[model samples]
Target: MAAQYDAVIVGAGFGGMGAAIQLHRLGHRRLLILEREDDLGGTWHVNRYPGLAVDIPSATYSYSFEPNPHWSRLFAPGAELKQYAEHVAEKYGLRPHMRFGTVVTGAHWVEEESHWRVAIAGGDSVTATYLCTATGFLSQPKVPDIEGIEDFGGKVIHTTAWDDDYDLTGKRAAIIGTGATAVQLIPEVAKVAADLTVYQRTPIWVSPKPDYRIPPRLRRLFARIPLAQKVVRAVGSGLLELLMISGVVHYRRLRIANRIAERYCRAHLFRQVRDPELRRKLTPDYSFGCKRPTFSNTYFRAFTKPHVHLETSRIERVEEQAIVTADGRRTEIDVLLLATGFNLWDVNFPAIEIIGRDGKNLGKWWRENRFQAYEGVTVPGFPNLVSLNSPYSYSGLSYFTTIECQMQHIDRLFRAMRARNAKVFEVSQQANDRFLELMRDKVGDSVFALGQCATANSYYFNQHGEATLLRPTSTRNAQREAVRFPLSDYTYA
Candidate 1:
């Protein structure tokens, strides 16, 4: 079967869904979504790991336009979130526009016509004038490099891509890596697993989630008086802004936040782990903000369980029935779990080479000269291509805020092109270069570059060793910067 559309969106996450809903509302009727999973929720659909839930308040995490004041709790569980995404799709009647269980492996731009020839398996193709890569940052799972991984006889699970049939009850489990996923899983798994050994490469600073069930009456009140919830969100967002403000100015507030986090961690450490030697070993050496700060309601208490063991030694390798640490200690377990997080800065679309004007391959161009996008959506050589959660656009606030801004900018970009009967709309090389110059010079000095962070493997930094991806900034500030590169900044041929 052959199909055509004005735009092709990849991945069905918050970014892709936001694009679809907004574009459909804006009168782009012929749009198609390619999703690898059978379900509508991208990350939420896949990660069925135990005790998975959002850290942010449920009221603020949703779409601002389609507010769901019916959240059951302050932070929603994964199942609730999955159902929420499905509900949004149903409400917007977006199912017919989606193609589920289809994996898009590659895409290329046909230079003359300026259309994207997206290639998928089974010798299928769909050509569209505009391509939107909404494959969000967390879609790809990153398993760490471990020796003798194949030798583990018991079932192995990755938190990002989980197996629902994995039964942890009465099982001795050796969990590797203590990132966000591990923090959530530890408490749940400790309840059932006979013995739980959590391998921590470095300790992470965590705060009480302050989460609770939102009663129906309160939810109804939120729906009616959304301003109250909005104010709460604003206040929380403002608190986060201090980190960016201080980091941007190289002020002492950065140190203040760091000291506060350190003190909190110490309090928790002494409160939970009574052994001074273990507490010292578990303490982190780097600053708190350098890593993605983890929030948990019961993560610290989970460590206090008698059945739970905290292993600090780096894993040497896996044997048939045990995990061998560097100290030659063997931790025998019935299952091994990987809580290693996602590949943050990895480009989602890399299989197909895109050739633009001057016949430059996209990958080669990006490698030779770093990815240059005006507002991190439109590229200099590529015409009519818009990406979501794209490079350099990862804000500290909600993704909905950023995507809506990008979509609005894209709409303006295309409107400008249509008004002028432009054959191609590509950012001028000067505009692209200037954007990168601002990114590295003006923006990279923020708290996102916490060189003193404990979790040193964060994907926020790019190849140039600069933190250009995730940062703390207000929606107004981000949109202002994004909308600054007016459609006129791009050469419309």
Candidate 2:
């Protein structure tokens, strides 16, 4: 006999926790949260590399329902965020409902039983009436396919899987991939390593981060009046919405901002790096916001250091000792750091074989249909299943914005189900197609579609070269649409 649950949520991270909290509040009983890891705080717990911090402002990154007045810095560190996750779990009594160290390997819809039978690792199974996968977009870490990568005798570490025991001090370190993680880790690695070489595949647009600690006076005021924190978050969100509109959505409208951003980058590069040649090498040729934009005040400054060297060449292969370049230059490295990002659009889903209607694999369906979801929540064939952080479902600069919107959407669907006395809520294929059509129309005008995103080699695009990852709308529009959209779009049975 399988343990039964009203709802079974996957991945106890921000998305999972948020879903659990919302479901519980909405009167869901016998809900279970299955976390693969022994603990919660999914991404925050895993990526513990040096100098790791949230790029977004701390004020906006948090949930609107629960605002913490005691964030130590404007850009909170990984540990603090992890503590915050634990705090949320403890605060809401979510720990009791969570089954840590439990991995859900597969899920099959029991059409006759009108429930989902989930197969777990270690020979266990569970049944749930409602299934919500909050597995997250960036959950799976992507390692580059390079020859002799496994043959490396030295310590080769990915930023996602940081070995706390491994020391980088006085060792010749080489960091591959100059994306967000590299931008943060390089400066910290340069501080300790004897010599550091940053191998850049593509130059990314990095803006200055205005990060500082919140004054105790302000914290006290936020604690005294929570509205104060809400106001701050609202203002920041508004500003970010404008950025998203002009820079991301309107596409061509970002010319002015692009000029300003490039100027700022050039000025910052000039101020930080002494060598003109190095500065030029660091400068990006692509337009701003082509790929995911980054922020770091110290990354460029790290290059000014004598021990740091920037190598922008095709990596020939990964030898036991050195990373050889196309031009036949080999740099000896004691520690190899891979800042290579996640498997975003490449079958990035819950680590479970989900068999929907008629034994249709959700993974195969997604790949076949180009990853379409009805409002990024429900698939046509997957009855009573909701996916948080799904493709084209994700919007807003802050993930909290996306989570909140998703929660609202889920709440609406739940309310609809109750009102109609529906046992199943599956979106119609027509509805899903219409939603994708709208997204396609909106994305056509966005920088991701019209801009240099294709050449930028961004994860925003799938293997099919379609920009279906991000919701092509402003945060406010996305939120409003998710909440107020027509429920008739889905079929209630």
Cα shift from native, residue 450, model 2 (Å)? 1.6
Per-residue alpha-carbon lDDT of model 1 for 1-493, expressed as tens digits? Answer: 2236878998787778888886776677999999988878888888888898876667667777777777888788988888889888999888888999998877777876677788887899898877888888677777778899887898888887678777788999988887778889899999999999999997776766778888898878878998877776677656655543344323233557566655776786677777777677667776666666667867777777889889999999998899999999998989999998876545543323455556666667766677556677777777767766556676654566677677677767767777888746787878878777876664444545534643555666566666656534445667776656566688876
lDDT of 2 at 422: 80
Candidate 2 achieves a global lDDT of 0.85
Candidate 2 per-residue lDDT over residues 133-195, each given as its tens digit: 988888888999988889988999999889999989999999999888889999999999999
The whole-model C-alpha lDDT of candidate 1 against the native structure comes to 0.74
Consecutive 10-residue window with the lowest summed lDDT within model 2: 344-353
In model 1, which range of ten residues has the least summed lDDT?
244-253
Pairs in steric clash, model 1: 287-452
TM-scores for the candidates: 0.92, 0.97
